[model samples]
Target: MIGQQAIRDWLFINGKIEKAVHILSSLHSPDDKVFVNRKEKDGSTSKVPCPLALKDYNSNMNFVDNFDRLKKDNQCDRKSHKWYMRLFFHFIDCCVVNSFIIYEELDTDGKKLTNKNFRREVYTGLLSRKLVDVQSPSILKKRTKSTTEISNHKPHVSKHLRLTESKHQPTQISSRRCAMCSTKKKPQRTK
Candidate 1:
C-alpha cells in the first residue's frame, strides 16, 4: 500500500498538483462574501464587503461530490484520485480568475470531450460555463520519400555497369534531369 506522503511526492514530481495546499486553502472562504479591508484618509480602517458573494468551501465540496459521481459512473479513473484532486484545484483557480467556471477544466481530455456533442453538454453543465474553443494537438504526417531518392521503399541502384558471372551487365536506366542546366536526358544506350 502506498503511503499518503509517497502519493503526494508522486503528484508533486509529475507536476500533477501545483501547490496543492495553497490552492485548497484559497477556496476556503469564511462566508460567501468578498471582504475588503481599506484604510480611510482619516487614518481609520474600514471593512467593505461585496454583496455579490463568491462560492464558499461548500462549492468545493460539491465539486468533489460531482467528481465522485463521475467515478461511480465509470466516466473517470477511480485510481487516479490524486489527479482528480489536482484537476479540482485547477478548476477552482480558473473560476477565481475568470469569475466563471470552464468546461474544459473538468474534462479529462479536453479534445476528446469537445468532439462529442452529448459529452460536451454534460461537461458544460458540470462546469457551469460555456467553452469558447477547445483546441487539440495537431497531428503530422510521416514523410515516406526522401528528397534525393526516387523510390523510398526500394534500394538505390548504381548508375555504372555491374560484372556478373564474368559478363558485363548494363545498369538500369534512370530518367534524370541535368543538375546545372535543368535539362531532361535519357540514359546512354550501350552496344
Candidate 2:
C-alpha cells in the first residue's frame, strides 16, 4: 500500500536495504503520503506505505477506514450474506456514499445535512417511489394464500417426519374428493 509520496530513504528489511521505493503521484496532490508503520521482530520499526494518500487521521479517514465507518454507521455490515450477496452489499454501500457526495456537491445553497439525515431521505424517497416496497395488507394476504396453496400440496418426501414403518409414509392415494373437482371422487386426489 505505497502512497504517492516520494521517499528519500530506501526501504530496509532487518537493518538491510531491500529496495528503493517510490509511490506514484496522484492527480489531486503529488506530495501527500498516507504513512503507516510496521514493527519488526528485532524491536525495530519500518514505514508502511499506502497507495492512496489521505488527510491526517484526526481530520479525515482513508478510503478503507471511511468505507468501514459507512458500513458501521448504516448498519449494513451483516455477516449472513453469501459471496455474491456480499459483493452486492458492498456495491450498494459504494453507491450510497457516492450519492451522498454528489448530493453535498450539488447543493448550491450550501444546505448542510448529516449522513444519517441524507440516508433517511434516500430511504424515504425509495419507499415513496415503491423501489423499496414494504409488505402491505394486500400483499400479505396474497402471500398467505400462496403459502396455503403450497402447504396443502404434499411433497414427494417427508424427510422431517421420521416414520419407522414403511406403511406410515405419506402416499398420494387418499379417500377424499378433489378440491378442484368437487363432484369427482377418486382414490388419488390432490387438494
Residue lDDT tens for model 1, 1-191 = 11122232122111112222212233223333465565788999987552111224324568777555444332322334688776775554434333223444665665533223444344445651212232232411344454653545542222331123212333444734323323225544334
lDDT accuracy of residue 102 in candidate 2: 78
Which numbered prediction scores highest in TM-score against the true structure? 2
Cα lDDT tens digits for candidate 2, 146-180: 43233464433223323432223443447544334
Whole-model Cα lDDT of every candidate shown, in order: 0.37, 0.53
Residue clash pairs of candidate 2? 1-49, 1-50, 1-51, 2-50, 3-50
Local error of candidate 2 at residue 5 (angstroms): 16
Give residue 88's lDDT in candidate 1 (0 to 100).
Answer: 76
Q: Identify the runs in model 1 with alpha carbons over 4 angstroms from their true place.
A: 1-55, 75-103, 106-191
Q: Count the backbone clashes (under 3 Å) in each candidate.
A: 0, 5
For each candidate in turn, the TM-score is 0.16, 0.36
